[model samples]
Target: MGGLIFWKLRGSDEKPVASVQPPPPATTPQVFEQPPPPPPPPPPPEEDAGKKPAGKVVGVGGGGCAGECKGTAGATLQSALAAKAGAARGCYERGLRQNATLQGKLVISVRVGPGGQVCSAGVASNALGDPGVASCVVGLFRSASFPAPEGGCVDTQVPMNFVPKGGGK
Candidate 1:
């Protein structure tokens, strides 16, 4: 009875269908180069139109270190961040691919351990509006190594400004 049921289910002359498979992906990836950005537009004609611009007084101000660091620690930390600026810019450029007018300031708070290793880092303030970009920049700072501080752990703020090409926004 089981054999008869199997024969009936197998059907009297139906052909078995073959399954189709998709082709494999390419071994090498393709890369496309981006064109250079255009030059900035000329500045608007003198607003005052023949009147000498009034001179303004500028004042310089700064406060003491925010952490136990002293001496050239701040400068050293800034220099280290500058070294990674290009990478951070790359992150912003990736975001610009999504939003052409994306532009803002990201204040990164970084804490460096005694061995010149980054203990913790995060975006203290992110006006860029792109969480992915902010996270990428923070990851870069977190993996970076700054100059050891004179005292113990050093905490500092690194401000990075991202402006799209041609200064859109």
Candidate 2:
């Protein structure tokens, strides 16, 4: 009766189809991964870590021209002026030709923009006794380039001394 039932199900006298096979076992052994070790603890703060807070000024002396300038801005301006020293000297010499007695200091106040550009410059003090020389010095400073300062702008003064080529009155 079982054979008759099988024949009825297949409805043919052909050999029965091979049974479906299960997938082969994995050749490599499975790995049980361990979670990564906890991250290292943060380093301890230094003794002088909080000496100067991120945004506060500690002391007020170490800066440009009586603490008027700060950071690399002062150095940047100094170097820029130093680079153009020849031009400034030329201006002074020209003024000397006009008046052989031209000898003194010219203090220039400069305003530097945030993008390392000279916004404006003017003669703060002029002991040279010549407006032409003062104006020329101010123009030279205005054309100078400095490194961008951290703050919005930098206001600083530079003094240039002019001495007569020949020591005379």
Candidate 3:
């Protein structure tokens, strides 16, 4: 049986050779010109930093001044805060996951340096009763940029009223 199987497998006694022969060298040197690459794609559209947040974020006026601490314009602070409304809403929304009905007033105290940098920021007062939301909102303010305060450092309080979508304020 072994001899019969070997005979059947070795039926083709001729050895098979596989080889690829390279093309003969060209008589004249060839010069090929490659086409120029396509122009770089246009930059993506920038997000609207001023876009209003989905949640209700009513602006309140309370830019009181203290000794040596100048008070910035409410409109200026409001514009800066409006730019960050979406992020603030994000913080509120994150807390909403924990408490679906999390909504209240938040007074964020921010100190802006003469160079328009946030020197310090914190939750001056939070009625939301959610520490996570308060911390998140404060964090957003910490990295927020604003117009340079005239004269010296300016301390401002931004009062924001938060109400969930479709909910009464």
Best lDDT among the predictions, by candidate number: 3
Candidate 2 lDDT over residue span 39-117, tens digit each:
9977667635654332123232233222344434556656875666547888888898899878988888876655566
lDDT rank order: 3, 1, 2
TM-score sort, best first? 3, 1, 2
Worst 10 residues of 3 by lDDT: 52-61
| Whole-model Cα lDDT of every candidate shown, in order | 0.71, 0.70, 0.73
* Clash pairs (backbone) in predicted model 2: none
Runs of candidate 2 with Cα error greater than 4 angstroms are 1-74, 166-169
Q: What digit string (tens of lDDT, one per residue) describes model 1 on residues 1-169?
A: 9999999988867887898888897688767888889999876668543232121101111212223544335567667777786679999989989988889998888766555667578889999889999999988987777776545556778888888777744
* lDDT string, candidate 3, 52-99, tens digits: 211112221222122356655456756876677556988888888889
Error of 2 at 47 (Å): 57
Which of the predicted structures, 2 or 3, would earn the higher lDDT when compared with the native? Answer: 3
Candidate 1 contains a number of clashing pairs equal to 0
Model 3: how far residue 3 lies from native, Å: 35
Tell me the number of clashing residue pairs for each predicted model.
Answer: 0, 0, 0
Candidates in order, TM-scores: namely 0.55, 0.52, 0.56
lDDT of 2 at 80: 76
